[model samples]
Target: MQAFTNADMSDKGATKPGFAISAWPDTRDILARLYDLANKEPVLAIKREQMERYLGYFEHKCIKSKSMTSAAMELIPGGVQHNLAFNHPFPLAIKKAEAAYLWDVDGNRYIDFLQAGGPTVLGSNYAPVQEKVIELIRECGPVTGLFHEYELKLAEIINHYMPSVEVFRMLATGTEAVMGAIRAARTFTGKAKVIKMGGAYHGWSDQMVFGMRIPGIGALESHGIPAGCYEHTQECFPNDIEALAAMLKNNEAQGGTAAVILEPLGPESGTRPVIYEFNACVRKLCDEYGTLLIFDEVVTGFRMGLGGAQGFFGVKPDLTVFGKCVAGGYPAAGGVGGRRDVMQCFAAGLQGLKKRAMVGGTLSANPLSCAAGYFSIKAMAETDAPIKAGKAGDRLTAGLKEIIKRRDLPFVAFNHGSICHLETAAAMLMDINNPKIFTEVSERKHVMEEMGAAFTAEGIISLAGSRLYTSMADSDAVIDDALDRFDRVLGSVEKKK
Candidate 1:
């Protein structure tokens, strides 16, 4: 039909500046661009190819993310849920993970850099922790519906490490503990308002998700969350105490602001690591207002030091929520810890320890999770695992810095401990006023992801975003292995022409 139309149009002597049919060439050009967009270099096409190439390797990965998605969709809205975990590629279905390795449904092995996004500080499936869980499973059953010995032991170890946790309560996720801490703060101080640093991710709950680096201004990413809930949850810029003070003072008419929540190191995402003064000012502000402060240490806890960011920064929050290394690499563990009076609201009986906060889940403190956690903490405490990881992270971070310096790549690497945090040379890649950093993130991001994929294709696996981690299992050999891959990937991305 197009040919016939072209013939008819041609027969008309290609009527110059005349009929509607004469504009056929321009229409064809537009259609050609659209077709290119579907299969070639336009935005959608480029993004799709990236996703396809990346995810297509999953069958060889031996993990079945599809099965996980199918099972989760029965109860979750988007197969498996969580916004950050979502990627251009469908998530890989994970079947088993052990000692820095993962097995997918397709039975392929991957060196894991996700490390549960920074929780597996000691490496996945440590032998002692696994043995402890198995022993508990065989002897005491999975969950008791009553108190277990491991719970108290675990808390005792935590208290030994962090003095801020005078009293604490356990839950299943960092999200749960964060929400609980907010409730405790409000209940203890009789205040309704809270403050959070922008770009930091505390949890997924509606109340805490506001103003958290949503890639756009004043727009919250979480759906079904009531604006009324965030009306009192003020968002402040990190490292700027004045902005926080202004918001607190400005919102003073909105009722009492009970708490300020921050990461105490960096805002966790979308920004670089911060300095100590940044935290000190916020602590000073909290002290001035008589408001309780909460540190959402889901990322920094234990990974930073024995006391996590509190020990590292020497600034403590009134309440702290911990996950990640607190459970080693096991399932169903997270908790809230802080001053006694605040935690008193959650007692089980008539006293503070026994008073019910009217929230309970059969699995909130389930025994299997507690068992794994108990050993995880105990094992980390006994061995030099934390220190080992920290030292390894230092080495890896140092090597990266050397690479960047030598290659003159626009990249920077920093680490608090076993975690690798990096940012692209994009601050140098585009003009200062590029309208949208995210708009170009697709093209520029491929350079890093392809680098990562190449790293995986080599012998080591790294976090999907170029983040790396060191584990207790990591040694001079492990470090060399990862660096070989790292050298290869880094060489490609920032290689001098």
Candidate 2:
């Protein structure tokens, strides 16, 4: 892999030394290519025969997994507890995970590029973090509905890395953290409305669910939830600074905007990459509007580097949301950290003067989670795991690009450090205004699902066949092997007629 130099860093932002992302992607170039792919007729997809063969892998080779998921479907909705577990055919029952790999219940091995939905940057079931977590569990157990020393230690480490996070409060999941952040924002700013970049998922929280995955389709997936849930939640398209400014300006007449929350890298973990200067520009806008800026770093916090995205972008958000990697891939892994004044709104117990956000979780900041997070972060810093993982992402992305070019495929591949994206169908890029938008999106999505199954049959596990998260565990040899597998799947592609 190539070593990142200052020349490769984004000139528009100040990336701290040893941060994960070496080169900020050219957003205009990527968006242009994505739009072209989306607008292309007869979506290029894996051949029908090839797809059937790939599906056969689950039917024949993964009999145990199929049986297990079949039984689970009777009990669990969608046959899987998590969205990431769903696949084209069925969910595979993963029995074991180690650095860079997973073994299904059927005993089949796979190169784990999903990385537990972008949490395991040091890689799956990292031994160092696992060992510490086990030790803590054996000693004091997971949680006690009380305080733990590790909580303070973890918060200290986080503050050391992310100075913008002057105070921290742990939560059980990303959803809870997002809720807390929004409540705190409303309380601190004394404003009701919050604006999020469209298609950027802060979590499954009601307010954040507006315009999810695809921009401009507001409340399309908000079934069962009341219309009033997201009434104050407004969305603007990614990288559209002018639209965001106009929305902010408009919000002034409607009781003002409380906060502007976003994923600094762009929506869906850079699936829609943002311009290099986007974060700084948003910061300026927030400052101008007197609105709190919340950085949803659930996927980018420690994984992006210990300093987090705010540090890389050199734009300090008023609050930063943490999840996934916060507890070293352990359960109950999420938190919100920010300026002291705002975070005080989440202060536990009764307070006379200050208005509190009223956030609580019985298992939050458990001893096990805090211990695991502290150890994991220490190991990450000691080993420069983020930089190593980023190099692996760069290598994988470069290899995929080469294969795409050689095969003359209209696929687009890019990476933000360890978070790699390979858009085969551009399903998420479909325009909402098109008359047949739903039909087109569904067809393109099916193609993407087929591509995912193809990759899985080739012994690779990717996120929706489009996203792949590299880690410190993915060595040059590991990445090369995975590339060959990806090539095999891509080789079966055919333009749909």
Runs in model 2 deviating more than 4 A are 1-16
How many steric clashes does model 2 contain? 0
RMSD of each: 17.1, 4.3
User: Residue 407 of candidate 1: its Cα lDDT?
Assistant: 64
Q: 1-497 in candidate 2: lDDT tens per residue?
A: 11222233243544458798887767777888998888865588777798888888989999999999999999999899999999988999999999999999999999999999988889899887888888888888887878899999999999999999999999989889989999999999999999998888888988888989888989999998899999999989888777788888889999999999999888999888878877777787888888999999999998888898887888899999999988888888899999999999888777887787898888898898889888988899999999999999999999999999999888999998899999989998876765667778888898899899999999999999899999999999999999999999999888554
Model 1 deviation from native, Cα RMSD in Å = 17.1
Whole-model alpha-carbon lDDT for candidate 2? 0.88
* Pairs with steric clashes in candidate 2: none
lDDT, candidate 1, 1-497, per-residue tens = 01111112211112221111111123223223322322333221113354344455544452456567657778877765654344333455667788767776666676666677877667877887888888888998788788987788778878887899988688888888888888888888778898887666787788877766431233346578878867667776545556677766665676667899888655663133453355656676677777888987887777665676776556778899887666666667689998888888877666545433544667767678777877776677677576777677777777777876776654656665676655442321232223555566566566546555555555456665556766776776667666666665566552333
Error in Å for residue 166 of model 2 = 0.3
TM-score of 1: 0.79
lDDT of each prediction vs. the true structure?
0.64, 0.88
